[model samples]
Target chain A: MSRQNFEEQLDGLHRQLMSMGTLVEEAIHKAIKSLVERDRELAMEVMKNDQLINQMEHEIESGCFRTIALQQPVGGDLRRLGTMLKIVTDLERMGDHAVAIAKTTTRLMAEPYVKPLIDIPLMADHVKAMVRDSLNAYIAKDDQAAGRIAAQDDVVDKLYAKIFRDLIEVMSKQEHTINQGTHLLLVAQYLERIADHVTNICEWVIYMTSGQKTDLNK
Target chain B: MSRQNFEEQLDGLHRQLMSMGTLVEEAIHKAIKSLVERDRELAMEVMKNDQLINQMEHEIESGCFRTIALQQPVGGDLRRLGTMLKIVTDLERMGDHAVAIAKTTTRLMAEPYVKPLIDIPLMADHVKAMVRDSLNAYIAKDDQAAGRIAAQDDVVDKLYAKIFRDLIEVMSKQEHTINQGTHLLLVAQYLERIADHVTNICEWVIYMTSGQKTDLNK
Candidate 1:
């Protein structure tokens, strides 16, 4: 393959990845919206759309493998392709977590919430922004932006901890709340995990740009 | 690199991956043991050893990338290498789940028996077996074995659902059990996720051998 052709292929793969990112971000948003509004139909939609995200991952992954085989890219080119592989895996996982959140929404649809859905949605918004920022860093090859995105994981973690504690307290006081409270805790955890995957993306962005593996997950 | 040299390099990478797998299996065992025995030191050990797993993932991933760049392997060889990359991600995630279980152990150290943890340890044993079997299948290129391992995930899921219901019942009945019960629920969840990762490895195993992407996770 010619250098220009390889560059075009990489650009195409990047575009596909961006589209997958958009789908994942939508899944996260709709999953939370389904939960907050108790919209079973929207939750089901997130679950069904996850298959499309999975299919996109498979397509992009095959594209990466084919390009690597034909182009034999090394150094920076190799790293960029490799980062795309890792990023897709992370994005696919984020999609799965969204499905889990949607499942939780479905499970809890039978009863009223123990508390208002405040922190969980706030946490989701932070993670969604982190996801968007991380992808932007990937496209711009901005290691500094990637570092800043990873730092936001701490904010997500704090929100999760607060949600956990508050839910545990609520469940302790009211026996009826235990079932949904635990499920809500899992929802917060799934969002927190989505943020962690975004942090992994940030780490990959930094590594692809700078050739240094920084543990931003800490 | 010569064909013989490349084969040798691939074999070396495989050995490294197996060692990492063994470490992951041991981490799962020790994490669950720490939880069941309330051994803080054992939990600490599992937490400490997780760094080793992460480091190994980095090393092996770099090795895979270097080999792929140097050899420009295609077809089956390329798939095998790609599978290794994916398998390491699954193994690293299992290690992280082990760390999560260990962290839960530390968090719940102030508590006493929450129904004696019979099912959680049993669930861990099953997932640990699934991990071992999945790696064995990878080494042998036994897609049939991979199918069996993926089937075992159903067992793990069933166990997890049972644990979730049992704990929710206990916590709903006894307010004091709420905190520990929730932590135990997370532990069971970590185990369930580890099994899911094992299933992913199984899917990769099938794909590597057959060149077909099957969703064994379903």
Candidate 2:
């Protein structure tokens, strides 16, 4: 392939990855909303959407292989392709976790309430933002933006700490909320992890551009 | 580099990656034991070992680059190195999550308990087995074993479900157990995540050998 053609193909590949990211972010938001609202139909929808995410993962991975084999890309281009391969795999896993949470949410549909769904949803919002900003940083190659967004993961960490404390208090004081509280805790933990994976992708993006590994978490 | 020397270096890289995997598995197992036993000192020790995991991730990644650049390795060798790059990243993330759990366990040292630890340790045991078997599959080049181990993640999934139910019941019956219940829930979630990442590495191993993607969860 010509250099111009390869560059255009790279652009297209990035667009595909970003679109997948947007789908995953939407799935996460909808999955959390479904759980908080006890909307089984929405949870089911998220589960069904999981195949699309999986298919996108397969497609993106094949695209990476084709770029490597056919284009034989070297240097920064090769690194970018390799990073995309890793990023898409992480994004696919993030989607799977969302589905897992949705499945649990469906299970909890039969169970009674525990605490108000405040921290979990708030953590989801932050995770969605992290996913968005990380993809944006990748598309734009904005290491500064990626670093700033990555640093915000500490906020999710703090939220998790607070949620742990609050849930423990609820579990200890009341017996009725135990099962629901645990499910909610699991959901919150999954959201925190999604944010962490986003931070990881941002770190990779920084490495791709700068050829220097950085801990964006700092 | 000469082909003979290149093979030797690749062999050394593979050995190091496997050794790193063993260290990470030990870290995870020890981290969980620290929590289950409430051994604050062991938890701190696990926290300190996080640096070694970080260093190994960096070293293996550079080793991959050097081998690729010097050997211009092709076909199975190239894929092996490529897959190693991704697998090491997942292992590093698993280490980070183990460290995160140890950090939380340390914070919970002074606190009172909600329920005796049962499911968390059980879940950790399952994850450790998965980690071991998956890495074994990678080293032995046993796709069937890797596939079987990957499918075994459902065991952890079911354990997570049972644990969530049990914890929720505790919280609902007594309000005071909420904080402790939440921490236990976080611990279970971390173990579940560690298993998921192990599955990912196993999938990469299968892909590296077979040149075909798979859904190990299925």
Best by DockQ: 1
Question: Tens digit of lDDT per residue, candidate 2, span A118-191?
Answer: 88898989899899989999888888888888999999999987886686566666655566666676777788
Tell me the lDDT of model 1 at A179: 91
Residue B62 in candidate 1, Cα distance off native in Å: 0.8
- Residue B67 of model 2, lDDT score: 75
Question: Which candidate has the top score in TM-score?
Answer: 1
Docking class of 2: acceptable
**Candidate 1 - CAPRI tier?**
high
lDDT of 2 at A47: 93
